[model samples]
Target: MTPAAIIEPPAMMELHRVWKVYSVGPVKVPALSDVSFQVTKGEFVTLHGPSGAGKTTLLRLLYREEIPSEGEIQVLGLDLARARRGEVAALRRSIGVVFQDARLLPGRTVYENVAFVLRVLGTPRREITARVFEALRAVGLSARAQAYPAQLSQGEAQRAALARAIARKPLLLIADEPTGNLDEGMAAEVLDVIRDVWAGGTTVLVATHQKALARTLRRRTLTLQNGRLLKDEG
Candidate 1:
């Protein structure tokens, strides 16, 4: 669809009475029921819940991979309902996402994996070189820049994923269970990388079933249960 004139959002995000329903055969199931919330710029937040509680669904909607069945979602000043293809693409470019498994390219070196995103965004070679190093340094993986994903340990792979996400210096980082596959020690390492990025002023939203991680981060937490918001604690 064609985009409308850009309208600056009043906040970093605004979701009013949002609902997301999916069709499985004939019956419809709700993934998010009347979820309404906003995230302020540069704020760190967590969405923690057990499986099937809509955390991932909510993140997908925010990133524009899917649209809510009902309600308004304005993120980073772009109205999802009205945002054109280019607008959505631009919006996504401003956000970074990480998954439970470090989705690094098996064949690419760590530095190339990080550089891919910048190349897609048309960044200059010199700037990409600087940013890639900066990101790798932040994740403590400078020495492994030439290592292939398959050669790295799980922890190193996750660190490389973090470096790739933060290389472009996106405004928002949405990590969906980034440490889900890690041991406590490895998870702690990943969390440290996230904390460093947050300290650098990137707004972050992490989804995890691990309650302790949320508490350890000492960030605001939003809990979802069976598609409904249950609790919000800081």
Candidate 2:
């Protein structure tokens, strides 16, 4: 899709009465129940709740990593429940996801790790180099491009992961507990990067259990408890 096409979609993500349940020996465990929200382009939304509050499950549904047991989802204008496999893949290309773990490639250099995403999407080599550095610079990792994941500090590794995600210049960036494993100072640093990215016009949805972090963002926040949306405040 062209840049214009990507910009045309007003709602980057939407959920309508979505439910997700897991079956364990005739017992059904509801991970998410009747959750509904919309994240539009250029918005920074936060999803915060304690552990086991189904935060991860909700994000999985949005990214098409898992299917909801009931209800509908629209991501980048594609109906997730009905989208073909190729269509879903295409949708993911426009979305970026970060987890609590940096999840970097142990064998690859930081530069290569960031470039690998573009390579998979068939991005040109020239563009890949430019974008990789640009993303690294954005996350303040350009100087560590030659280092391996194991060689970096926890904060740096996460920043590298962030660089990889944003390198694609995705229309929507989803981070799940991005600062969960960081020290307070590091967490603040990482969040500042995220805020800067949002300032640059990329829509962001962050799922974290840290109430302080959510409050720091000062954006639209959705609270979940026992799989139910408890509050939505700005």
Candidate 3:
């Protein structure tokens, strides 16, 4: 009898029994404990928790900003615990990250801020312009390309920041508290842009403390509390 081959789904991110502890002199502060989950390619996942619930820590682990104290993490097929510095750097280039703050260059125009990332990766000048505009257009910020960061409203600045993150057309997009600083209406606006990006086939993981926001996303939700995963609702 011929045996059939087992088909496994492609994984964009995986974490197995991961733990993270920070040492503060004589005390050890545990940031995450025994976390385990998997995010397959082209899936939209949400991480929801209150402040101090380790959502940020988990996202940091995904992009290799912080290594786990124990267990394993593989992102984009690279073992984060064992990958070399260069390998980690290369992996990060394929992953886009958005923080609570817009984090755009204050002195630069929105166009320049978005173009800067591509330029750092050695993208040609001609390509930079096109790519920047494409990303800005995706976030509905194309008309404000020449405006400085300070000239933008809170929502516009956040959109500009999103344009910068997606400029590289990353394989995965991770956002941590992306709408933390915005009002409810503004937050919805930013989240809609994120949803649009995910719909465009970029794997996405959003970390937020808002229950309403998580419900709005309507995707697989992983809930974290006090560094422990309490629920994974699909």
Candidate 4:
């Protein structure tokens, strides 16, 4: 007789009435206001908007780099606001972020940059080596593992950044303007890598001003204007 299959629970990320504001000498600057959304397991999403539209701010909130001024943000059941410091760190272990600038450590070798997060989390040296190499191979950067960021072209460095993001096998991946600096072909290549990553069951959210790319992907899109959600279409 065939055995019954086990059902894994769904992964859900939620943001509830999130508001982010900054104070500058008695002046309040709003970055995001009353934003609420959710992304389920394996979904690919895009946050689309013009500059200063709070797209980056929204991504940062998900990454827990910035706490919301009001409301709550949760990822995979962990509340960003109430989680302990260690808990937040632990949550981050299963999340990956690719910043707008690639942001690779300029002085480190490509492999080392990719391995840094694991080392910070005290992963074993052997495991770190294995994972880093695997990530590099996954991003098609294995041959340049020893190269420095300075030696890589913009597109190559972006790929390395993506490798670093995926090295930990994060459950959720967030990318901010990942292809902003690339040409049309390179942008397509970057999006292809992102799509492949999403296909592997990692939820992905890419924030970009590039409407053409967003439209091409045809993923659910959320737009922001004046710190408020303007449109959300799935």
For every candidate in turn, the CA RMSD to the true structure comes to 5.5, 4.6, 1.0, 3.7
lDDT of 2 by residue, 160-225 (tens): 989999999988899999999999999988999999989989999999999899889889999999
Instruction: Encode model 3's per-residue lDDT on 67-152: one tens digit a residue.
Output: 89999999989988789988988898899999999999999999999899899877788899999999998988889999999899
Worst 10 residues of 1 by lDDT: 7-16
Q: For every model shown, what is its TM-score relative to the native structure?
A: 0.94, 0.95, 0.97, 0.93
Write the residue-wise lDDT of candidate 4 on 110-199 in tens digits: 999999988987788889999999998888889999999999988889999999999999999999999999988877878889999999
Residue 206 CA displacement from its true place in model 1, Å = 0.4
Clashing pairs in 3: none
| Model 4 root-mean-square deviation | 3.7
List the candidate 2 regions with Cα displacement exceeding 4 Å.
Answer: 1-9
Clashing pairs in model 1, backbone N/Cα/C closer than 3 A: none
Q: How many Å off is the CA of 147 in candidate 2?
A: 0.5
lDDT for 73 (candidate 3): 94
Question: Which scores greater on lDDT, model 2 or model 4?
Answer: 2
lDDT (Cα) of model 1: 0.91
Ordered by lDDT, highest first, the candidates read 2, 3, 1, 4
Q: Can you write out model 1's per-residue Cα lDDT over 68-187, one digit (the tens) per residue? A: 999999999899999999999888888999999999988899999999989998889879999999999999999999999999989999999999898888899999999999999999
lDDT values for all models: 0.91, 0.92, 0.92, 0.89
